[model samples]
Target: MAATGVSANRLELLQIADAVAREKNIEKEIVIEAIEEAIQKGAKSRYGAHHDIRAKIDPKTGELALTRHVTVVEDDWRPEDELEEFNDSALVRLKDASKRDPEAFVGKEYIEELPPFEFGRVQTQMARQVVMGKVREAERERQYEEFKDRVGEIVNGTVKRVEYGNVIVDLGRGEGIMRRDQSIPREIFNIGDRIRTYIYDVRPEAKGPQVMLSRAHPGFMAKLFAQEVPEVYDGVIEIRAAARDAGSRAKMAVLSNDSSIDPVGACVGMRGSRVQAVVAELQGEKIDIIQWNNDEPTFIVNALAPAEVSKVVLDEEADRVEVVVPDEQLSLAIGRRGQNVRLASQLTGWQIDIITESQDSERRQKEFAERTQLFQDALDVDEVIAQLLVTEGFATVEDLAYVEAYEISDIEGFDEETAEELQARARDFLDRQAAEQDAKRKELGVEDGVLEVPGVTLPMAVALGEGGVKTVEDLADLATDEVRGGFEVRNGERVRVPGVLESFNLSQEDAEMLILQARVAAGWIDASELPQPEPEEAYEEGFEGEDYMAEAEQLFEGSSDAGAEAADDASDASGEEADDASAEDR
Candidate 1:
């Protein structure tokens, strides 16, 4: 018998290593190394702990060897710091080495063979623990390496056990965990049930690999369709985006590489069999397969299927889309609790605001009237000219002020001379407005430093001063939302007072950026704490000019004030004259 109570043939050692490696799904070399370590530990127990002993097994022959080694040192040798790493007993002085071998020289190594020990219960138990520990560590490493790359891939497994609402699965080679939240809504799995899931994550822990599986992830739905649909699997069709409510509803956008193949039809399968298979696996979750379109408006319309979209107005600066559907289709477009539009937004990566046709028409009319009034007042133009300018997509006084002369001249009934005059008037109006606001800010005793903050316009500084935020420190002390929408008591309820940001129709992101800038300006926060600005091209179109006043003009142009109100009369008078002219022509 072997020293550790194993068979003496030594071939048994190799056989055992092979069996353990196969069972643990680890490398044969790892198992062999574990065995060598166990033998070395056993040798240490038999030999004195201070002696330098080594054990090795022949990889091919399975022959085990144990030897005690000593390094020959010169007679005048003194212990150096580097020599301290070696065991003192392992260093044999030259005088002492002469007894063993007169030919022994410094730096030479001498080895003595050690006789194998008889089997001992304590030694056998210790060796067993060491081998088992090493085997477990090796197995963990193997499991991590095997599953790490499998993330985002679909895997099938059997539910081994249910522990506190979590399902432990046997994946043939290793174990995986499908946490309760990772499962589809209201889905329950019993022990021994076969399941398919997405390998969303794989984490290596001290105990073993944590293979996190999910059926509720949107990628899981996409992967499931890939498994059931041949077109998707063969790469003829590619899923572009997917969003899921898990066990309730899901939407997948797919595009076909081959124009002859309809991606939606292929995903739906022969008589809906392919899509049904995925739905069945997801516990009867309803799925909508939409054809992908490169055109953003077309894609958004497709994403909001089963609901007719009459119009889609994209606001690129806000990353939002205003979707108008027929009055009859409003409920369907919004779905129950807005799920339809929500899923569409997720699929298209755009925030969607669904409205009925009537609502959209009314909003457009209001915007037209507002812009017409703004142009009539700011440019001192007649209602005909204001309406024509608004029709040409000039929404703000700043648009008329900063636009190239060609943009205005290109409008009907306007030429180079008229366009130049309009632009000059627009600039003069803005200068007067700025001078008035500066006078008001000074009257309110607001510090000039507050005006230097990135997003703080003259009107905003005046508003802040009136609100008791006269200094940059005061502005920095405000919460982001408070700065965006002022805090006030309204109708016995505390509410936002529609602050400068709200008045200017600025987004919450813009408001937050202004607050961060204020904090940096006040020295309350380091400049590095502020987020980096986007590249020049990424800034809102038409607002990315070198002139800072262009942004301020855009912000304050639409504000309802005495000047804007006076402009309304000009628009009304001009409208009457145009109506008279139209009647005469008819």
Candidate 2:
């Protein structure tokens, strides 16, 4: 540890190791090892770099030893390191060594102890840098191990400094960063000021471990409630979900396992004392504590409190909900800048659209008229007959084409002959539509093999042809995002691009299935590789959670025929729109 020549007593060496280990909060053995490595570097600089010089220090006695080892090796021995060609000082050929000692063979080592020497200025500086680097590395590792597992826990710290509006806090044992975006809006922190934050993430970076702290995280609010509410902390009441427009408004859903206890009332606390404490810490943010329910409709209704909802229509496949509210409550339901509805969407895990009753009525009527017109034109039926079919729940010509004769005949005023005539017309119309789609698909260069793939219809084949996917291999090489549609960033704004199958409203599973089947038909993968249904118990235990569509796309893209290369060059830039929420900024 000293720049002077080894003038210090042996006891001083042990003391230096113990002091450094204590100061850095590392193991004494690590500090001793660091010193040993520093000595090795210094020795290498003094002796030839090609010489195999090693240094070792005694832990109990602090006795240091330096030695040089020259090993006898095969005449053609070559270093495994590509950067190294040969070293004559550290290695000697067996034939050459045998001239001095007949017993000398490959792997035989001759060790020589070196006398103590004075430390030069350059070697001293190099040793100091090496020692400091190792110690600093150990300190960073210790800090990471201490904090990585503490994620999701609330911690209190004092602001150490601010960089670019981000607050760096001194957390007693480690440093944490509260990113500018992760802090509550308008909340300022001065150096030395105390702050409470949630440990959302801890990453070991190249420079050091970064503890990502957040004051505006939903988990922060949830943790605050646990500290204030005894029932929540004790597990009697569970905070099922939480969403926040940090420092402005928030919503939390609570569920009570006990029938006798009210989750909302308990969270509200006696005379709002518990809730008030949390709000004070959050800079006066308003919180809506709603009762959580198992039924999704009931849950959505509860999530949009203070607004009277007339009806809720849930689209399970799309994870969207259409909520109809009274005209007067529309403003209240949407809140200022759509905050209320956004929080509700986040809380319920659904995309919510709040519309007034009048709007819903108008949309229903428009849809009904469109369906009626479609039946009239496709079946060549009169308005009266089309209206009857629409009222009977027949929305498309395909519906009449596929329905059993008895079902259509059972409709009031529709006998077997009428049903038969309607079905005959529906079938004839579909046949002509299929033929037209097939002609277009062929003209677009889509192969007949594409239509033969499982789950692919003629209309889908035509859509694929338009999107630049022609052959079975081309279809198999499509990512689920490309087929299901996804959003793309353009000119700094997100824009939705429709996928080839976007109009078909295919679910994620269905889109993946289409690509998987196509891959099988294209000979890229075996049909036996397709996933099969498993029992619920077994599925839960081993849900490989594999993405067959993505795997197939990766396996075949850029590795297929010239047709696939052309398809890739001509692929559509559009994709499905991704789901999003406004309160996501929080």
Candidate 3:
């Protein structure tokens, strides 16, 4: 008879499959399918040649059954097949002898049944190994799917072990890997210790799901806040931005949709209880909660908490900001390694260059001193001349050099010879200043520093004197042509200023550079150059016009519709054209 306990073994195997599924958190059907495939492979290898074989186990009863394979033989081979079948196995026999083929060839194949011994001890062991492997693989796939989308979410787990500074967390379903880099420095964990972390990432590999956990990400704090704050969870309070130096400190900008609720106060809780809890969870890491702002300067001031910003100078062209703070708050605003300001820059998406009030004043003073020294050096004068000019209100190079020597003599206690000396000294100083200014302007792609020859007509000189446009530096900084109301041309050609060469003569490059700068500075002009008029006495020019027309007649006749339209258009187009034109210049 067959092995009487085969049914018992099958029932035990089914129970083992169910237990494995439960232990691995996999579906029982997966284990069942694995076992079925394993058994089919083993049976095919053991009995495929002689007969078709099938193995199956009942899901409900767990009963194992086996079947044999067969094919009908021709009538001519009937007696031979019956004899061969009887010889093939003691359990095999031809049920219909008259249907067998007597002349069946040697190569012809037939069918027969073998006992359960077909999958004997060796084959059964191989099948069991395959099934176990497949079951483990299925379990890993299930675990990966469960956790992949869970990144950035908070998860709680017990610490199973620590190896080389990494914690192995038992996350109920599987062990998640928490790398040393992911853990806050100085944090400690012991076996069976319950800890909270973020599911930072999940990656699938040949072995299993690699679930990465993080305790130090800035978002970890935000996620925890959401869990703790009902308003955040319900979307009433929104976290506008967050920056962190991981375990040491963090800053969060928050805003509220509900004006009735103060976001900062709400997040802090009464008596600092709520924020204190978050800090406690972070193991004493400091947190600063600030009000979010759309204005960069206001936002930056908030980001540099505890330090008051007196002013912000935004260089929008460079996407940079210079923040001025009180003298006492310098160290606070800069922090260690400029960490405070750096975080503020990162938080606000602007490059911040910070200076204290005293520091800025000192820097400007130093720059002015250097300019004065250069002036004295070029003029071969003593410091007294610089001091005298500075005392007499001729502080800027443009003021002293470009205004004319007569103006210097006009000051009390000044002789013509003294005035001439001062004018020469001032001109020398302008040349030096222009050289330095041009270097800076060239560096900024604003202009090429070139000095203008001292021979241009008084009108052209006055036009150039409107802020000392003799050098590329001056031109590069010109107001946009639209703002100036028209472009200035010299001799029917756009005036080009030389860039970054000491030659006093205006080259084509210099003229082009000048026209570009004039366009920028004057805030007016077209693709073509319009002749710039010589400077005349402002009062005399207007007085001559007044001589010809009465006020009412001027209002009616002189105020042309075209002129009004042009003025309005220029006003509306001023800054916009400058921005676009500057971009094109770049």
Top TM-score prediction, candidate number: 2
- In terms of lDDT, which candidate is stronger, 1 or 2? 2
What tens-digit string does per-residue lDDT give for candidate 1 at 78-156? 7678555545678888888889798988899988888776657767777788889999998888888889999999988
Off by over 4 Å in 3: 1-13, 44-115, 118-125, 313-321, 336-339, 349-351, 366-586
TM-score of 1: 0.68
**RMSD (Å) of each candidate, 1 decimal:** 11.1, 11.9, 16.4
At residue 499, candidate 3 shows an lDDT of: 29
Candidates' C-alpha lDDT: 0.83, 0.88, 0.70
Work out candidate 1's RMSD over C-alphas: 11.1
Model 3's alpha-carbon lDDT is: 0.70
- Candidate with more favorable, higher TM-score: 1 or 3: 1
Error of 1 at 380 (Å): 9.5
| Tens digits of lDDT, candidate 2, 485-512 | 9899999999987888998899999999
Cα TM-score of candidate 2: 0.81
Backbone clash numbers for all candidates listed: 0, 4, 36
In terms of lDDT, the poorest run of 10 residues in model 2 is 572-581
> What is the lDDT for 106 in model 2?
91
TM accuracy, model 3: 0.57
- TM-score of every model? 0.68, 0.81, 0.57
